[model samples]
Target: MSEQSVTYMDLRFHTPAEQKRKRRPKHTRDTEFSEQEVTYSHLKFHIPSEQQKQQTSTSAESTDYPTPTSSWLVTVILGLLCMALLVTAGVLGAKFLQLSHRVRRQNEELIEKQAILGNFTQLQETLKNCTNQRDDLQAQKANFSKVVSRKGEKCSLCSEGWIEHGGKCYHFSEERRTWKKSQEYCSSHNSRLLVIKNKEELDFINRLVCFHWIGLSRGGAATAMKWEDGTAHSTDLFQVKKETPGESCVALNAEGGAIRKCAEEFRYICEKKPS
Candidate 1:
């Protein structure tokens, strides 16, 4: 009601101040009394005891909700950091070991290569020495050839059993005999008529031969030259006439009197111990 209407009635004016103070305005008591309640102070906005209790209960429930940092967060984080560092350190240490091993292997390989190179050099030196010795040997061979050819150009003829000795003449009339009988005779005596070898032998024999028969001859044009012993001809121990590899008769050389023959009569030249 308007204060003017309440004074016109005069009853509210006579009411005690204490009693009036105790009474709240109608808008404060019943929510339906006003379309909207305006609150400007704590007393006006104060919530009911029941509603406050309900709010307290709801806040208590949310407080019990778990959060990430509530338990063991520091310890767990510290442990994880330590693990990361340990894993990183372990990886680094393994890599370092691998690298170190590789380096050592490389060093060993280099050392081995150097050793091989040293051995190769030593082998080269040895080979060089061998080559030098070989060259010297070849030179000596050439010199020996020259000396032999000059001494063997001439020979004497008409002697008994002449043997060609070292580029010279030596006669052994004891060894002389006819071609066929000479082979058998020499076999009995354990000594054979000398077989002429090269020009040296021919020259030497000529000096001693007096119609000595040789161990070589062809019995006919188609017959092969051979020794009287019935064995095949051999160039290893005896030599035939210069070009008479195919000659067929035995005779003495005109110059050296060296015994020679054709297939018809092959004087034998036997070989044995030096005695």
Candidate 2:
């Protein structure tokens, strides 16, 4: 190998004359230099110092960091957004409570109305029952009045064919019949042979007809007089007249009641109550 020549690089710019002679194109003519450049003739090697590398790394890290003012603005914007979300939630919750209250009130009103309607229905039923009772009472009153009026008319007067006295009627017959036959005929006409309770009735009959069969009679025993209804007769009404010792039948005349034969046929008088 030949002997190597060692050269030192000058840490200085080229001279203007040497630069003009080379006439190299300048790519950074207007740019300012951050560090000084050194040239070595016939060499193409580059190496950075430890101090320079450290400075470049520090600049890059500084560019990534944010400023104090920008960080404060971002924090404030986030806080505002959180506040808006809270307000919206509160409004929605209040609206839900209001809806629930309204629904409960409506339900209460509906229940009250239904109770009132039920009471009204009961009242209507009671009124109908009372009306029915009133009508029934009115009908009973009308029927009672009709019965009273009919009874009064009957007691007031006797029929045209009857003789009236003391709220009673009497029929005098001229046809002759035995006492038993005459009683049978009177019963068929819903009447009875004349019964003289007092002197007034006895005298009234005497005036109408003479020697008619009477209801007075002597019992089967001799001289024991009794009325046709089986009661003993008192001598106060009229003195008894016996044609014989055992005359069981009796007759009435203008004077007094007399005992007569049962087989004898004579006029008769029948007595009856008004219809």
Candidate 1 global lDDT: 0.52
Question: Could you tell me the lDDT of residue 129 within candidate 1?
Answer: 55
Residues 1-275, candidate 1: write the lDDT tens digits.
Answer: 11111212222223335555457566566643433334432222333466767777677876986455655787798899999999999999999999999999999999999999999999897567545644653564354335434434543221233333463333333344556676566567565545555666555444434345665556655676655456666565444444444444555533322334432342234433332
Instruction: Kindly provide the TM-score of model 1 when superposed on the true structure, using C-alpha atoms.
Output: 0.31
As a whole number from 0 to 100, the lDDT of residue 12 in candidate 1 is 21
Best by lDDT: 2
User: Cα-based RMSD of the predictions, in order?
Assistant: 22.7, 30.1
lDDT of 2 by residue, 81-124 (tens): 99999999999999999999999999999899889989989978
Q: Which candidate is the best by TM-score?
A: 2
lDDT of 2 at 141: 39
